[model samples]
Target: MASKMASCIFCKIIKGDIPCFKLYESDKTLAFLDINPLSRGHALVIPKFHGEKLADIPDDNLSEILPVVKKLVAATGATEYNILQNNGRGAHQEVDHVHFHMIPKPNAEEGLGIRWPQQKTDMDKIKALYEEIKARM
Candidate 1:
C-alpha cells in the first residue's frame, strides 16, 4: 500500500507533492478541479486514505465525500451534474484510486455522456437474484 501510494497521482496531490486547483480538504477527503475537465467546474472528490476501490475504503474515510461534492456543486453554481465513480479498468476507471467525479452538464453535448442499454427483464430471474443478494446483505 505504501508503494502504491507513492506512485499514485491522486495520492501525490493529497500529499502536496503535486499541485492542484484545490477546493476543499479535510482529514478524510479532498476536492479539487479536474485538470482535464469534461465541462466547466468539473471536479473530483477523493478519500485521503489510499484505496483503489470504494469497497476498499473505510466508512469513516468516506463519510465526508458526498457532503464535499454537494458543497462543490453549490460553489460552482452547477444546476445539473453527474456524480460518477468507477471501480475498475473494465468500468472506465483510469486511475487506480477511489475517487468520485462531479461533472457539470451544461448542455446535451458535454459531460459524462453514457448509454443505458436496457435489457429485457425476466421476473423470476430478477426475484431470485434479488433474494440471493438480499440474503448476503
Candidate 2:
C-alpha cells in the first residue's frame, strides 16, 4: 500500500477545497459531472481517498463506485453506458486520482470512441502470459 497523496484534484473536491458539480456522495465515495464531458450527462465517480491507479485502490473503495455509477447512468436516462477507468498517463489519464467515467452513450450517433485497432496474437505468448498472471493470483 502507498501513502496518501497531496494536491490530488479529486481529494480536494471531496474536501470542498475544490468546486465541482457533485452528483452523489457517500462516506468514502463521490460522483460528479465532468466539466469536459464527452456528452451532456457524462460524469465521474471516484473514491474519496486518493489512489493513483486502479490497483492502488482499496477493495472497499472500489465496491462503492459501481452503485454510484448505476445511479448516474439511470439519472442520465441512458439506454447504454460505458465505464472507463484509467491507471496511467499512457492510458490518457489526465488525473492521477482514481476515477471511473460513467459516460452515457445512448447510441452510435453520439459519444467517445476512437478506432480500436485490432491485431493478430501468438497463441504461445498468450498462453505464457495467462499462466504467468494465474500464478500471481
Candidate 3:
C-alpha cells in the first residue's frame, strides 16, 4: 500500500507533493478541481487511502466522498451533474486510485457525455443472475 501510494498521483497531491486547486479536505477524503475539466466546475473527490478501486477501500475511508461531492455541487451551484466512479480500465477508469468525478452538466455539449448501449433483456437470465448475486450478498 505504501509503495502504491508513493506512485499514485492523487496520493502525491494529498501529501502536498503535487499542487492542486483544493476544494475540501477531511481526515478521510480530499476534493479538488479537475485540471482537465469537462465543465466549468468539474471536480474530483478522492479517498485519502490508497485504493485502486471502490471495493478495495474501507467503508470508513469512503464515508466522506459523497458528502464532499454534495458540498461541491452545492458550492458550485450545479443543478445538473453526474457523479461518476469507474472501477477498471475497461470501465474507463484512467487513474488507478479510487476517485469520484463530480461533473456539472451545464449544457448538452459540456460535462460527462455518455451513450447507453442497451442490451436485449432476457428475463430468465436476469432472474438467475439476480438470484445468484443476492445469495452471495
lDDT of 3: 0.94
- Per-residue lDDT over 1-137 for candidate 3, one digit per residue giving the tens place of the 0 to 100 score: 78888999999999999999999988889999999999999999999888999999999899888889999999999999999999999999998899999999999999999999999989999999999999999
Q: Estimate each model's TM-score.
A: 0.98, 0.89, 0.97
- On a 0 to 1 TM-score scale, where does candidate 1 land against the true structure? 0.98
Off by over 4 Å in 1: none
Instruction: In angstroms, give how far residue 103 of model 2 lies from its true place.
Output: 0.7
List the pairs of residues colliding in candidate 1.
Answer: none
The residue-by-residue lDDT of candidate 1 on 79-104, one tens digit each, is 99999999999999999999999999
Clashing pairs in 2: none
Query: Which is the leading candidate under TM-score?
Result: 1
Model 3 quality (TM-score): 0.97
Give Cα distance to truth, residue 26, candidate 1, Å.
0.8
lDDT of each: 0.95, 0.85, 0.94
Which window of ten consecutive residues has the lowest lDDT sum in model 1? 106-115
Candidate 3: residue 70 Cα off by (Å)? 0.8
> What are the candidates' C-alpha RMSDs?
0.6, 2.3, 0.9
Better of 1 and 2 by TM-score: 1
